[model samples]
Target: MADTPQANPQTARVLSVSELNRMARDILERNFPLFWVSGEISNMTRAASGHWYFSLKDSGAQVRCVMFRGRNSYLDWVPKEGDKVEARATVTLYEARGDFQLTIEFLQRAGLGALFEAFEKLKQKLQAEGLFDETRKRAIPAFPKQIGIVTSADAAALHDVLTTLRRRMPGIPVVIYPTPVQGKGAANLIANAIETASRRAECDVLIVCRGGGSIEDLWQFNEEIVARAIVNCSMPVISGVGHETDFTIADFAADRRAPTPTAAAEMASPNREALLNTLLQQQQSLQRSMSYKLNRYMQQLDFLARRLLSPAQQLTHKQESLAQLGTRLQNSMLQLLGRQQEKLLRLSLNLQHLNPNAVLNRGYALVQTRDGAIVRASSQIAAGDPVNLRFAEGSAEADIRSTAKPD
Candidate 1:
């Protein structure tokens, strides 16, 4: 292949691969800058230098791509093998390798709306399986004895959560279950950490947290497996994965969702001032109730004392009334006795006028039989029957030797 045109003397002076590659890169960059390119990624590799190398391919051809550490560090999403992505890149050269490549400045999932749609579909599928059920969610302890933190140990989110917890509730133990928060295998690692924390039963509540990021950066929390682990964990979980508006599957799966790391700490802690205020109000109400009851009892005592009358006073009043009654009773008895005596004398005189004994005393003689029966008729006398004669001065018994009947 080198013999035909490259054999010529003039053609031997042609630029080296490095020189040509550099010139091509400069010209391409000058012409097309900060432009977007859409393609499927292949052969993706992340080097120890934190740089990314990949190939962008379509049905027709493929091109080498590079994302230096500086640009790669700012990327929210890392391209994976077979992933379709759009990159804001600069056409440049790899001088040492003498290769033409695209140096990416920014990278994002191609067709973000499509990605979101796929995400939603997966979320719905998991939800239908009860993976997002509220019943399955563990209750966040009102006061967690120990808080288990699931995040990258080196992440700023960890420090934020720690600092906030220390400030809000001092002496509360924090158990860190460090895991990979981003990049490859991060989702699996985070999911396992959650499961481990739950299985161990070392913490009362689990906080799955991370610093703020774009949607792609927070994608691990949106993964189905990670979300499932969070929902299935026995421990009460609180998700503080991103800013206030950022939401993920993990957030939906957690029993409680906090907007930020600081907010999560707040949720786990009680406000000292609020508790104190409540206690004070209760004490004051008790005091008021006691005072009211005491005052009512005191008034009752005062009323009882005012109504009380000494026995001596009651006896003196009764005795004074008794003396008046006794004097009036004596006068009434004397008047009644005088009237009764006068009435009795009049009755005796009237009775004397009515008595037959008075007539007898005036010189009436009465005859009586020996049986003490007066003989009014001679027919009442029997022969040899005894008779009695009565006189006004004295009555004497006389026996009638014979009875005579008037002829």
Candidate 2:
């Protein structure tokens, strides 16, 4: 024998419990992919940390399962013990306990898998056809004159909607088109009622609503006929079906989606109290503006009245001005007459000094030739010339004496 192949203690491989468990978990995770499992829930416990601990078992086997808070928080409904459910999970081993387990990513009611698949398929088809395009949606009237409703006559949803409408706006008229909202042929009847409302064209807006229920109970709204009818309706349509957590195909096709029937009525009507408040504010503003304008106009009228003059006062002022002008004219004329008289007296004195007859009266004789030329010098008279002499009062005719030079 080859010395019995003695093992070396220093070279032998050994693993701790934690390392072994970790290796097993990695191996299980790598081998089994995430997959769906269907079973009844048992040993359900909701931890204070919001995590869920449970066991999924069938008739033959059971497995430990855990769903973290992040995963279960998005679920609309809570799962309970003895509830049949489907889980999508991955296989793993708990490192501390050395136990095999599953970590769940999603959970749903056991039989709803087919329904969810159908809903997703239809949603994708309609989206591809542009049925859910925002451009195709109509605008909801802010003040609808008339409202129309399509629902079962006996539905509690109808009562809720009517009460909301009446409370918000009682003056607006509401027309109801009774139709079946559930059961075998409910989709076709709802479509007919919508089409009838559209043809009549009596309402500014339409509401199609029903109360909350399970997915199966609300499945009629997921039909193609109802969606097409909502898309083709003449007026804007508001769809309020099921609770806030529930959604149907009609919600996508409608102009607006409400969480409940009461919300849909609120969307279609305006509040009377709010409108009255706005009107009151506007009326007060108008009254203040008018009062300000009237006061300003009255002040202007008073100012103009002060500036205005009477016809009699105007005539009296003109007469006073005319009298003053006449007095000034009379003074000017008297001064002019006195100046003219003084000028005439000076001229008369000058003329008297230049008169030849006045010189003759002062012992001087005026001599002239017979032809009437006055003799100014002794040289102008000749010894044989005939001459005439005139005094201030008489005239004499004589032969010229001899002329002599004055010594």
Model 1 per-residue lDDT at 104? 87
RMSD of 2: 8.3
Worst 10 residues of 2 by lDDT: 1-10
Candidate 1 per-residue lDDT, tens place, 1-407, comes to 56564477675677887778778778877987778888999999999999898999999999999888987776545567998888888887777776778888878778875667878988899888887777777666777788899999999999998888877677789899999988878999999999999899988888899988877788888888898888778888889988877788888888899999879877876656666798999999999999999999999999998888699977997898899899899989999998999999899998998776787888877877766686788788866776666675767666567767778
| Most accurate candidate by lDDT | 2
lDDT of 2 at 358: 85
Clash list (residue pairs), candidate 2: none
- Model 2: residue 347 alpha-carbon error in angstroms: 8.0
lDDT of 2: 0.93
Go through the candidates in order and give each one's C-alpha lDDT: 0.84, 0.93
* lDDT score for candidate 1 against the true structure: 0.84
Off by over 4 Å in 1: 1-111, 159-172, 308-407
- State TM-scores per candidate: 0.54, 0.64
C-alpha positional error of residue 355 in candidate 2 after TM-score superposition, expressed in Å = 8.6
